[model samples]
Target: MPSPTHDALRTPAWTPPAGNTKPPLSSRMMRAAWRGLPARRYDVGWEPGLVVPAPDGSPLITDHYFPRAAGDFPTLLVRSPYGRGVPWSPMYGLLFAEQGFHVILQSCRGTGGSGGRFGLWRNEAADGRATVSWLREQPWFDGTLGTIGASYLGYVQWALAMDPPPELKAMVVQVGLHDPHAFFHANGALNLENALVSGVGMAYQHQGLAPMVKATLRLQRRLREITTARPLRGAQASVVGDVPWLDDAMTHADADDPHWLGTSMGQAAERLDVPTGLITGWHDALLDQTLEQYGRLRRAGCDTALLVGPWTHTSAFQRGWPEVFAESLAWLRAHLCDDPSGLRPTRVRVHTGGDESWRDLDDWPSSPAVTSWFPAPDGQLLQQAPTDAEPLASFRYDPADPTPSVGGPLLSRGAGPRDNGALEAREDVLTFTGPPLTEPVDVLGPVSARLSVSTDTGYADVFARLCDVDAQGRSTNVCDGLVRLRTTGQAPTRVTVPMSSTAHRFAAGHRIRWQISGGAHPRYARNPGTGASPVDATEFLPVRITVHADSELTLPRGAAGTVKDRGQPRS
Candidate 1:
């Protein structure tokens, strides 16, 4: 009998085969972004240090710029904590310049020669609103405005969108978080490690030339170490929990807190009436935040368009994804530059790996996209629904012997789409497999779960991964999610894990699999079974978890979906 591990590429998604790459650019590769696209130099006015008063009149500084002959060029303002001069995407200097945008990159207060104290997103909308007021007063001003960027830059974009100015026309938000409270403290659990790392980066970044100089020397030394083939592994420990994060995630985890609630994008999406384009990677750790924001934007009929790809937190910066930049330019053109091709899609567009095509869908999933459950006997997964009523399955979540991270939407480092091969049989994981499918299936939107369980330790977490198991037995973790087990059975534990909304085909003979465990660390801080204080609470909760198929994962399924967009599934 042939083992079920002979042909894993059973139904490979749109990922170009293993060795394909972008056609070489006519431009230089990987050297530097300084050699940017040509910028039509129009004299831009910089009235440095003109203070824009905050809501209560707190002094805030802003920088304004536009085309020399700008009769009504849309204003593109990016109020970022990062310095204005050090181009985030060096190509933007050229890209936007050529696109006829008045890109104004201003360092937020307490950053890059700006005035006033910096208070993260808490003060973003006010500052952004103030800046817009300043821009309108400019000689070359266009009443319409749009902004763009990722992460922090994207965060501010959402903030501004919450209470947009009349001139605030549109935006492009990439990998931005939905709720800062949840981002800092995931699922009510504080991530001290992540908080520390960010805090350290901020402390170093805010330091003037002195620390920067020393950091440069250290980087050079690290570079030397790299060239010498010496690895600097686990250096992140030094910078974890480095800022006011303890207060953000620890002291402010409560949903009622003004600060925490104010940061949520759900509320913002409700008020944002302008057209928006959102792009994010499926494998990103912050995917939930972006996904939640997308759902709200669409549901609110906010004229928002969403695009998710098989990417990581920084997938946009990687080599194989220049198409994203082109798409982004189009998005901006539609919403910002008013171009025809930049028009928003009829529905969501996703790059499904298994199906190997871009899929356009009507609304997210209105029905069960694919229905299958884990056959629990002795850990070996049966890629089909469970007929026999097994009461429970078990796995040991040992923090010390963590499941080696795989490629997917995680923030930690990995080569490509992290394959979950190294973690399949860990005694601590509950694995389930589906028999080879005779037909193709389409999975869109959220992948939900309804598991029946009883735990002694007051708290537990369910980690579910939906993957494509090739004939060769390689289990590639396509998409997975986590939830607090305590919230199950007691209340509405109907948490929807962010699925990589794509059209994948588990061809005849290809298997579908799910790996259930306690955690996927680093990407998400491990949930110690104990619901003790997330910070300074070190005890693990031990509990009994029972998974019932009646309460199985609810997916947004559609049969071999019809092609509606340019990126249609390969029939």
Candidate 2:
């Protein structure tokens, strides 16, 4: 695995660091510096964006900024295709800039003020290299660097780190991708999170732009002509406008493609040498990817730290991230500035509900992590693990009814922070309960369900919810995950398979329940259970999918079980 050079990692170019506590510069100079330029006197004052030479004579270039105040200050680099001033860029500026560190926010080609067509992930390495090279030359740069951000911003950071820059000191990645394609197809099905991100980005891309022009741009003339005149003509075409490789990717969900292989952040971890800081929300749809990344880097002997919170993408965002932002700043100061003043850690700290307390740990998957099983008996998620003697819980999955989507982990325009109370009565869904624990159970880490399940047809869908059933019967969803069974890597006839992750603890008197069904429609496309292809194929089948719980869900029991599962106020 060849890595990009430390110099190449900071490509198209860099600018002087900005002065903190200084009065805001004129919008013209401010915008100019943001475009990777110094606020120097200009001839015509067009405010040229940063100009870094592309490795190849490709017309593509990047616009990046180095910190303003001083020479030789360590640098933090973030490359994103989204405009440089949006939340991705501003979020970092607010978080890292105040730490007395210089941060480089660069616009990827075809974005912000950079040049080039955008769509593929393969182009980042080259652009990242140009940005890094430019950062090293900046007079204010101390010649050391690190990378940080969430989602796409974080993806670019990871991509650059895999090919460490000589001065690439460290990284902090949140709920982003290691392998873009794998994230898109977690179980050989559609990557709901990726699809959502793509859609939201398109919506945000033109938010404040001219209304008429934005509306016109939303109409894809090329899309209507190229693959097909009408996207609705084929299922594959429908997802293309919003997905990275809509037509080709949807058609070959299970097929190994180059784009798929190249998206692997795990594979890239093999060549990694930088220390890393990881932050992920428990309810983040991409939380698993963050966990896998930290674990892989740790196993590879890279310095790594992790923090998992109850928040999801955009949920409890803004106000809540400063805590982790402070931690990242301290880490950079220690590693990049050689100032290890306050680095002692409480390790894994989780904010639990109920009492709103934080639990600390020495490590993630901390000591005393254990898993127990319960069977699905008479439609109840029985506490006893599964056995042949127990009758499996059965249900009919109707695509039309779609087991109405309740809140779990999501990142739509206005999702998360929802109560699952309304979904308890769907005929297609079943729930399991457990007696509350005598003592507080702090379960952190990824949760999985192991059970024997058989479907009436060739396909099935498993939706698991870990809720905090309060004394008053308010069932608040803490964390939940759904798996499309057809792509679950086993024979379709099997009765049980491992489902997705769940996070929540059963308070004494509260019961933990699992919902076995064929789908969580709208939130996710319902599996028809007919074994038809997911893309262009659409049909329905009533299948009796029984979850035999001799299988169990493995919860990440923290040393202190800091998982905060809270209850809603009773009506």
What C-alpha lDDT do the candidate models reach, one value each? 0.57, 0.57
Worst 10 residues of 1 by lDDT: 224-233
TM-score quality measure for candidate 1: 0.78
Q: What is candidate 2's lDDT per residue for 256-296, written digit by digit as tens?
A: 76546666556666557787787777667677777788678
Residue 121 in candidate 1, Cα distance off native in Å: 2.4
Relative to the true structure, candidate 2 reaches a TM of 0.80
Residues 69-145, candidate 1: write the lDDT tens digits. Answer: 43446667776675544334233433464456666766777666666667666778778888776665554454657
Residue 281's lDDT within candidate 2 is: 70
Candidate 2: list runs displaced more than 4 Å: 1-48, 58-71, 202-251, 353-355, 376-379, 385-390, 486-504, 561-571
Task: Give me the candidate number with maximum TM-score.
Answer: 2
TM-scores for the candidates? 0.78, 0.80
- Report how far off residue 55 is in candidate 2 (Å): 2.7
